[model samples]
Target: MSETNRQWLLAKRPDGRPTEDCFEMVEREVPDPGPREVLVRTRYMSVDPYMRGRMRDAESYAEPWDVGEAMRAGVVGEVVESNSPRWEAGDVVNGNLRWADYAVADEDQLVPVDPDRAPISTALGVLGMPGRTAYFGLLDVGRPKPGDTVVVSGAAGAVGSVVGQIAKHAGCRVVGIAGADEKVHWLTGELGFDEAINYRETESVRGALAEACPDGIDVYYDNVGGPITDAAFAHLAVRARVVVCGQISLYNAEERPTGPRKLGELITKRARVEGVLVRDYVERYEEANERLAHWVADGVVQYRETVTEGLENAPDAFLGLFDGVNIGKQVVQVSDPEN
Candidate 1:
């Protein structure tokens, strides 16, 4: 066992957009596993939009990361030491291991990963939280019916990409809104989206929606809420469903977002807007993972990941999410397990 392990700690709460000052790298002793616990050597760590909320001290669906604590994140790792009967050395697993080289996981937290099924890193992305989020949020909340027109914001992102693909698989016309033309091309050309609009180049998102969705939007899977969400709301047809999976546009906002000025339209259209937290559907994780894995295997679903090397670059990779720097899931390769 190594005498020391390195980790990134939250140095201070960011006033707005986080900078390098918000994080501090530290080295500490690697603790031994206790009864029913395992020591995991992290391989890959995920950087997500929801983590921005965890950086703030304000009330949210989840607790904020405490200052001076190891910054928490979803990680895929190999068990180097285990005291739990359910796990053994060399087994790959995924859990909330934080931003560290190694972490101790209790029996209740760790989930074993099968490398033969899919890349173990998928446990942090397409086949994990983001996939389940899209499944439950779209199917259970958005409820897209066959022949309906479904739209997704942040369409190139992990959750939003799956949402659009799943809607298309459900026999609906899926429209995607992404940040760049390349992403838009991938969404429509490769992912089978009915249409894709690059919000960055398009002058008016509302006009784009109106042009693309002549029948009107029946289901809206919103990942990057703000003016784009407002635009989608304006284009909603009667009895439309809106699933609010995340608000990346609002995550970095120092104050509350003021974009959706058309709430009255919701009442006029009798549309329903529901906010979703992936944790709410934890009971169905295995089922969702199984379905997602099958979809991946069948080539019914495709995904991409923007991976950055080294643990030291994690802060940069995290900040990249706010700027649309990632094409799909943003991941950081901390250390090669074989090394």
Candidate 2:
């Protein structure tokens, strides 16, 4: 094993959209795992929109990342060494890990990944947090009934794509709203969405959405909040359910922008709008993972990944989320597991 470890540190807090300058890559001596800890060699790491919120020194569901500290993400790796009885060298594991070539983590913090069952990278994507977010947010919160019209914003993304698929399985008429024509095509063509709208191309999102859902939208799985959400809110069916999974549209704003006051519409429609965090359902994680794995194995659900090739490009991969550069999950390949 190499004597040095490469790490990406937060150089400064982002003002708006984060830049490469906000991160600094540095090298340090490989860390030794203490008692009850294991040293993992990172193979893949995830770059998600939620991390943007973590950059700011503000209160949220997760703690803010301090400037000058090693950046962290959902990481999958091989156990290089262990001081914990629960793990052994060569064991594959996944966890909330740092953006470094190697990291020392508590044994309790890591979960084993079965390489024979699925690609280890997926432990950070479809079968990981994104999948869980989609499952609980859409099913528990959105609560779409059979034949109901369900629309998902950010439809081509990791979580949104899964949301649309799970809605389909529940017998909903799934409609997806995405940023590009290709994403629109992929959602409807490959993912079995009943319809898809290119929010960026459509001159009137509300009109297009109205046309797609002649019966009106019963469930809206919102990932992008802004005009898209406003447009969705305007077309809600009576007693509709709105799952606020994310607001990527506002993640990079210098100041939170105000838009149409549609709360009155919610009142008129008697709709229920609820915000979701995956951590809220941590107790049921095993239940969700078992079901998601079954769906993937049975071909009842499908997924895609948009991967960046190197650890050095992790920051660029994250910045690309705002630009709609990835079709599904965006992840960074840190190193080959066997290497």
Candidate 3:
């Protein structure tokens, strides 16, 4: 490892959608590990829709990224030096390694990654935050039961895709909503979703929901909120559960977009709507990971990644999320280990 490393920093706050100019790449010396810390060489970096929120200076569940500081993200890397007895050189670990090539991680922050069950990268996608988001958000919050009708928006995305599959595995009749026809086909034909709707081409989301879910929607796992949420809310059955996982549609909006006026329906239907943060279930991550891994191993769950080849293309890769350019989890391969 070199004494200095190249890293990207948040140059300026983005007014609307983030552009390449907002990120500035610079070279900095590798930071030394303090007591109970480990130095990691990042191999893969995640570029997700949630990061768009952090770019704004406004208050959010998490702090905004500071100007001139390295951008943050969930990352997987190898420990090259360790100051703690809990880890040693050659150990692969995952944590909030941010968007840099090298990071110093605290002993309590990093988790070991095993390559035997699946690729180590799974720790960032299917077996990691996104997977846990789908599992707990749908099962725990949504409380889906056998024969329930479950509808998931952004069904082709990393989290929503898994949510729909897990719902099917739970014996629910699953319906997925995505942007393109191809994604709709993948969700319904290959992923075993009972039905899929391409929201972009569809004239009425509400009509589509009514058509797909003739029995009424028992659970709605919402990933891309906006008019789509309004449509799903309009069809909630009695005692229905709505899981608010994300609102990607409003992420790049200059102002909050108006949604359907359907609060009265909630009362009429005696339905429940709740927002979820996957971090709340950190204590049960091991259990979630085990089950998710089992599902993947048994061919009950499948995943995809729209990977960008070089570190320099990270900005473009990240921007693609807003334009529906990514088909699944968007990741940037900084450097191939075999290279």
Candidate 4:
């Protein structure tokens, strides 16, 4: 008898707004690690908005996954078998791995995770790429100043939640824009956002933004771009910094949707819109994790996670991003960590 590994593979390229049919589940005999590699049993897996971009046939920042091949994602796992001198059985590690029950990783591909420091799941959320994204996107790119009014779109998400809180810590008036009323309240209440607008309930997002940001938005952290972006641009103050973090709204559109021709406004407002990628600041991850962990401990920063039980539901969890289903970091619990 042989052990089997269950995996999810890309069934086909999506025409527009991928459905569950785009994914296929299969099982294969468990694989053994080669020299300098370790076999890991996955515990937690991450599903993010960026993964939507990967489902396309065209090239992008992330390499597209080939059809019939196992889909890859960020995962925290326990090393069950090791052929590398750097790792051993029972060691906890995390890296970009397959959406499967098990994965084989090279020594350099995975970094050690201290389970005692926090839940191992944090390796896939706040203490991971999402948190690093917020830290760099807000501090380095946005350059938010004290007394500045910072507005965060998708403010209830994994990255947006952190960005808004970090802005608050900077002594900025943090305004959040979310879809649901509870999400909006969560931002204004527990997250310490000065104000939050529920776009779904608002008659006009632009008008609501104008009212919330009476002084004009000094910093705009955009995650879900679309009409919200058009509205946010209209309320920018002089020399505003607009950080283009994620444009999740357009990720599923079959054809490009025409948007407001508002580039001309940048000339008058003297505003700067820049994109931030966490990979660009990979060398500074330790800096961010350390600072963020400190803030979480000091009650200055907070986080949340929406876990989808079982690896079989990973595709469903990923699709939920476009629908704004999850409140914070959306992850899948694949298995329990071995103590």
Candidate 5:
């Protein structure tokens, strides 16, 4: 085993869109595990839009990342040393761990990952947080009924892609809004969405949605807020459920956004809008994991990954999220197991 570990720290807070300048890397001796703790070598680290919000000093759903301190992310790793009865060397686990090649966690803070069930990398992607987020956010909050029209913004992303697929499984007519032409093809052609709109090519998203959703959108799964959300609000069906799973379009703004108030439109349409956090459904993660695993194995759901190699490039991979540079889950590959 290597004698040292390299970790990324928040060098400074971002005033707008984050840059690689905000991160600092440092080397430290790989510490041994304390009682009930395990030392892990990270294999994959996830870069999510929500992490951008954490860079701010202000409090939000997740705690803010303190400048100069080690930042944590969802990581899949192989245990190299252990001080707990439940774990041993060579066991693979997943958890919210340090953005480094090595980290130490209490055994309970990690979940055993079965490589035989699926690739270990999936514990940080499709079979992990994003998939579970889509499962509960759509089924519990969106509440789509069969034959309802379900439209998902940021539809080609990890969470959004899963949201559209789950909505289709519920027998809803699925329409996806994505930034690129290829993403539109994947959503409509491969994932089985009823229709897809390439937002960048269209002159007016609202006009495109109006033509596609002739009966009005019944379940609007919002991932990117802004003009697309504004357009979606304009086409809500009566009693439509709007599930706000993410707002990637607004995550980096330095100032609070002021846009047209669509509340009046919602009032007349009797639409319901609610925000979701995957952490709130922790008690039900097992259920989501089982079902999503089944769906993946059965070919009922599919996922894609955009991976950046090397831990040194974590910031670059993270910055890519805001640019819509990734078609599905964006993760950083830190190291291989047994390294």
Candidate 6:
């Protein structure tokens, strides 16, 4: 075991899109676990769009990340040392842990991960928060009925990709809006979406949506807000359900910029718009996890991961989110786990 641990601290609050300067790497001795605690060596660290919001000093759904503190992220790790009855060395675990190679956490703060079931890294991706966000946000909030047209923005991203697939499984005509042509292909070709639009290549998002969704959109699972959301709003069917899972497009906006005023569209279409926070569905996570696992095992649903190697590159992986540099879940590979 290494004598020292390297951690990324929140150096400064980001004014707009975050840069590497906002994070400072610090080295500290790898502390031993005390009573009822375990020392975990991180294997994977997830860098998500939601973390961008947490970088702001203001409070949101989750608390803001304080400057000069180790940034927290969804981490999958292996227990290297244990002082807890429930955990032993070599046990795989997952939790919201600091961005360090090793973390000393109370046993209750860590959840056991079954390496035999799936890749343990999945505990930070498809089997973790992003997957649950997709499941509950689309099913509980969007409420897409069979034969309904379900459109997902940021459709190639982790949550959006899962949202589209789940909507398809529920017998909806799924349309995906992505940034790149390859992402569009992956959605319509492999993931079984009925159609996909490349928002970057298209002349107008609203025009493309009109062409693709000839019957109008019955459900809009929004991951990227801004023009795409406005376009989706313009095509809402009667009683359409809109699921606001993320707004990555607006995450970096320094000043809140206004766009298409469309509250009247909701009134006219009788549409229901609702925002979702994954923490609110924690009580029902096991139900979603079981079902998602079954679907994954049966090949009913698929997922992709864009991984950046090394803990040192974690900040770069985060900056990539705003740049649209990843196709699915963006995670940092910190170390290899012992089998």
For each candidate in turn, the TM-score is 0.98, 0.98, 0.97, 0.98, 0.98, 0.98
Model 3: weakest 10-residue lDDT segment is 254-263
| Clashing residue pairs for model 5 | none
Which ranking of candidates, highest lDDT first? Answer: 2, 5, 4, 1, 6, 3
C-alpha positional error of residue 186 in candidate 4 after TM-score superposition, expressed in Å: 0.9
Model 4, runs deviating above 4 Å: none
Instruction: Record all residue pairs in model 6 with backbone atoms less than 3 Å apart, i.e. clashing.
Output: none
User: For candidate 5, lDDT tens digit of each residue in 218-253?
Assistant: 999999998899999999999999999889888988
Q: List the residue pairs that clash in candidate 2.
A: none
Candidate number with the higher TM-score (3 or 4):
4
Model 6 lDDT-worst window of ten: 254-263
Q: Which whole-number lDDT from 0 to 100 does residue 101 have in model 5?
A: 90
Per-residue CA lDDT of candidate 1, range 1-339, in tens?
568999999999999888989999999999788999999999999998888888899898878989998898999999999999999999999999879999999977988889999988888889988889999999999998999999999999999899999999999999999999899999998899989999999999999999999989999998888889888988999999999888888887898856468789999899998999888888888889999999999999999999999998999999988889898788999988667
TM-score of 4: 0.98
How far is 234's C-alpha from truth in model 2 (Å)? 0.6
RMSD of each: 1.1, 0.9, 1.3, 1.3, 0.9, 1.1
Could you give me the TM-score of model 6 versus the true structure? 0.98
C-alpha RMSD of candidate 5: 0.9
Model 3 gets an lDDT of 0.90
Q: Please give, for residues 31-75, the per-residue lDDT of candidate 4 as tens digits.
A: 899989999999999999888778887889999888888899999
- lDDT tens per residue, model 2, 11-127: 999999999899999999999999999999999999999999889999977789999989899999999999999999999999998999999999999999999878888898889
